[model samples]
Target: MTTRDALQTQLEQGIAALGLHLPADAVPRLLDYQALLERWNAAYNLTAVRDPAEMVTRHLLDSLAILPYVQGRTLADLGTGPGLPGIVLAIAAPGREILLVDSNGKKVRFLREAIRALKLDGVRAVQSRVEDVEGQYDCVTARAFASLADMLGWGGHLLAPDGIWLAMKGKRPDDELAGIPAGFGLRGTHELAVPGLSAERHLLVLGHA
Candidate 1:
């Protein structure tokens, strides 16, 4: 039963049906980052879902269903193409400090070869373009990229000052939450049930109004 033991038995029954209490080496480093993103999506198509059991329900349980609203100590995924949920929340929260950001270039060269083959540490990819990325960041993720007022008008100075911007999305946009843009607000909108995914997921959760 090896294909990383059938994707670690479908990521341990979808993290025990999303009660989620990860880190028993986070399901073998999320099945070794889904076998290095399905061996670099067979030469950099990065992701079109390409079945590794639909990359475990559309890329690792739709990127760990926002892993319990990820807080603090640096994050910053912004258009992180291949590294959804910023390399699956830096492989299930290995003490924060993620920073993926992407401008393409073969999906930032497969996110720096899956953060150097998942040794992962604090993690870091950066090809730039999230409005020329710089610093600040207690948290800030993005997934269907633009349109939360153009993703907080392009990375909203990389979040900090009580950060938090999560955003992955699918349905419930409500006109991108009424075009949020006066500093920012709407700190709630969750609705994810990924497990084997039925589609129509959401996350939203913004901050700093």
Candidate 2:
């Protein structure tokens, strides 16, 4: 089998292990996105994950691990470099308004291309600093983008009064949690077990106190 086919099988198995069901075309589209990223990375260096198999575990499954925690209608993926969970979430969750926010011109350009190529509806990419982004969303996601405190400090305004912030981290950021700004409280911290990946992954769920 080709490497792409192997990656696709891995992705399918990983999604099943997570107890999640996606559309029939979801897996194919996701693989297509990975292919696109691989082609773009050759020129733009969008992500450090170069291996297609590694991308399946590290990028695709890691992002989809938090699919259950994603709530509400609108989501803003702040500092979404190469659209990690943002783009993945858009493809997995249809009919939800997802906005990919990044300040890097090159990354934004790549995100726009992915959106257009994937033919994803109800999703858009904007080039702007997280702190300067306008409009409120029901959910906001940041994956290793910044410290929890700094992330909330900069893009906190973008979250609606009752919105949820899903922050993906490598370890349990107890120190970061201690520094959470006032008015925002830690709702929960979930240990994510991404299939085929053994690294420690935690999902910090935050909301207005």
Candidate 3:
């Protein structure tokens, strides 16, 4: 079997462990997304993970691990570098609309291509800074975008009042959370171990309180 096949097997086991049913059809789309990401990375510096095998765990599964906790009518991904959680979520959870925003033109271009290539009808890629975004979404998600405080200061505006902000981070974000200004309350924090990944991962859910 190819290395990619091994990775897919590992990812499938991880999904099974989570007790979530990933439809058989979604596998091909995830692979397509990985291919697009590898193609774009060659020219646009879209992502560091090149091998499809690594992409499954580092990019696809890692992003999808937070799928169960997302709460929003619509989701907006801020600084959506190569459409990490945004595109991944749109594929995993059909029916929900996803707006993926990034300031980098090259990244946004790649995002648009990935969306088109995947034939994901629920996703819209936009080129804009999070701070300058005008509309509100039911939920806002950011990964490796900025510090929690800075993210709250800018990305917070993009979230609806009742919406939650899903922040994916490494290690415990206690120090960063301490820096956030008053008003936002921590709804819940959970450690997620990505299948095929040994690193520390946590998903922080914050709400306006």
TM-score to native of every candidate shown: 0.34, 0.99, 0.94
The model with the greater TM-score, 1 or 3, is: 3
Q: Write the per-residue lDDT of candidate 1 for residues 43-149, one digit (tens) a residue.
A: 77888878788888888888887888988988888888888888887888788778888888898888888888888888888787998889989889898888899
* Candidate 2, number of clashes: 0
Model 3, position 19: C-alpha lDDT score: 64
The segments of candidate 2 whose C-alpha lies over 4 angstroms from its true place after superposition are none
lDDT of each: 0.85, 0.94, 0.84
Best by TM-score: 2
lDDT of 3 by residue, 56-152 (tens): 8889889989999887679999988999899988888877789999999999998988888888888898898788888888888988788889998
TM-score of 3: 0.94
Candidate with more favorable, higher TM-score: 2 or 3:
2
How do the residues 1-209 of candidate 2 rate in per-residue lDDT, one tens digit apiece? Answer: 99878988899999999999988889999999999999999999999999998998999999999999999999999999999899999888888999999999999999999999999999999999999899999999999999988999999998999999999999899988788999899999999999999899999999998
Summed backbone clashes in each candidate are 0, 0, 0
